[model samples]
Every structure is written in C-alpha cells, then in structure tokens.
Target: MHNGKPVVLVVEDSPIIRMGAVDLVLLAGYEALEARDADEAIRILESRADIDLVFTDVQMPGTMDGLKLSHYIRDRWPPVKLIVASGNAILEESSLPAGSRFFPKPYNDHSILDAMARMLAS
Candidate 1:
C-alpha cells in the first residue's frame, strides 16, 4: 500500500509532542494518525493495515510502553518502520532493529524530519 508517501502513526500521550510529530509528518507530505496512548495506537494499527511507520514516545502512561509497542509492531508487522523518542537517551543501540531509530526528547523539528525522511527513503 506504500508506494512512496506512506502513512505514519504518532503514538504519544503528550498532546504537544503528538501534535509536533503529526505536524512534521503532514509537512513532509505523509498522512498521519495520532493516538494518545499505546492502547489506542494498537487499536488504530490493528484496523489500519496501510500504516507504514510508527513514532512512539517511550514513556507512556500505560501498561505497555513504547519499547513494548515496538516489539509488538516488529513481531506483528515486520514491514512497518519504528521510531522511538524519549528522555532515555542512553538506550542500547543493539537492542533495536538495525534501521529502527531512537531519539532523545526535545529533538529539533528539523532533525526529526530529516530522520523521518531517511527512514521513509529506506
């Protein structure tokens, strides 16, 4: 379903952060869906098979955090790309998939957009 401009999902409980991510995706010409938490994100992904990328905040106010969500996405949808952003900047790179990315919170908008472009291109 992803020819060029693929759908992106932004899953973050923070309203500001989710809006920022959604704005970046929209500005980049990719369709985006925003969810307030991991549960909502999971429901949306379950229904929307066209979603090509997932942007999740690592610290969510729920039983399943971004790491768990990433694992679930990789297990269920191997083709979907995952990007995790958080204040936990010291995450081990080896724990994530080769192309999967992790960014620290308060990331510059341009940097995140650039990373998104790189991910989508690949």
Candidate 2:
C-alpha cells in the first residue's frame, strides 16, 4: 500500500477512458497511477513495490495487450491483484490468472469498485 492506502495502476491507451478509470480508482478510496501501454505499465510496476492492484483495458497499442500484461504481472508480482476489461472481447475465467476479475466494457462503476475492495480485502 501507498501512504497507508492500497495503490492501483490503471492501464489504458485512450486518454478519456484512462482518466475515467483513474477517477474511479480515486473514488474507490485507493491511490491511483496510470500507464498507456504494457511497456510503460511494466516500467511502473518495476519501479513501484506498493501497487496492490492493476485495472487494465484489454486492447492497446504496445508490445503486449492487457491480457498478456496481466499474466506478466501475475508471474512477476504474484501478490498484485488484477482487473481486466474489454469492449470487444469477453474472456473466460481460464484466460486470466487465478484470482483476477474480468469486466465487460461499460461495466458498472460500483461493481468494479466493489470487486477492487473485495480483492484487496482478501
């Protein structure tokens, strides 16, 4: 946690969506950080040890998309939680690492917030 609050990294390529996600993270009462793509996300993850969760968009312009990013995070930082979303695809639970949550596009903010809280609480 950062400053006694859980830290969440929001990863998305679109500025508008990224901003909204960051706002949601703040609304959920956690510290928020952002990255536009997998590479930048990796850099941020590598540089910070306090990040407790990652909320990422599935499609992005980068070496790897959010799915790959999530797996990478799970492999390298096993304690970090993941929440993956996509407008274009609905991934099965098996596709994501264990304990990760998936949300469809236009997902309810309250639901996502609840999921974050639940995941962090575990």
Candidate 3:
C-alpha cells in the first residue's frame, strides 16, 4: 500500500482508456499501477504483493484476454479483487470468476468507485 492507501492495477491496451482509469483511481485516493496488456499485468502481479485490486479491459492485444486473466488471478491470487470492463463483449455473470465484478464500456465513474470501495472494504 502506498501511503496506507489501497493499490489498484489497471490493465488496458489503449493508452487513452488506461489514462482515464488512472485518473479515476487517483481521484478516489488509491495508488494506481498501469499495464498495457494481460502479460504485463501478470508480470506486475507476480512481482508485487501490495496490489489490493485489479481493473482490466477486455479485447487487449495479448494471448490472454481479460476473462482469462480474471480466471488466472482467481486461481493464483484469490485475495485480489477484480473489476473487468468490456465495450464489445457480452459476458454473463456466471462467466466471471467468483468474487469478480463487470462493467460495460463507458462505465459510470461513481458506480465503479462505489464498487471498488465496497470491494476493498470487505
């Protein structure tokens, strides 16, 4: 934790989207980490144990998509909270890993922040 705040890792291939996420995370008083794709995100996860949550975007340019990354995290790092977002993909609630949440693209900032707060509080 950076300065006693929760750490949130954002994995998104698009620079624009990632920047937006980072802004929101910072505004919400969390430490933010950025990864361009699932592979980079995995490396960060492997190297850092301080991350309290992960916010990832689907349809990244990598071998593993956000769904697979979520599953991998659930299996390998069950303590980490997950928030998955997608613009084009239609995902069922059952498809997400246990304890994970989903947001459609152009997500509401308030809702996302509320969800993160709830997840971290739990």
Candidate-wise lDDT, in order:
0.86, 0.96, 0.95
Which 10 successive residues of model 1 have the least lDDT summed?
89-98
Clashes of each: 0, 0, 0
RMSD of each: 1.7, 0.5, 0.7
Which numbered prediction scores highest in TM-score against the true structure?
Answer: 2
Query: Rank order by TM-score, top first?
Result: 2, 3, 1
TM-score versus the correct structure, for each prediction? 0.91, 0.98, 0.98
Candidate 2 Cα outliers beyond 4 Å, as residue runs: none
Tens digits of per-residue lDDT for model 2, 5-121: 999999999999999999999988899999999999999999999999999999999799999999999999999999999999999999999999999998899999999999999
lDDT of 1 by residue, 2-103 (tens): 566689999999898788889999998999899988899989999988998899988898879888888888888898998888876546778775568888
lDDT of 3 at 108: 96
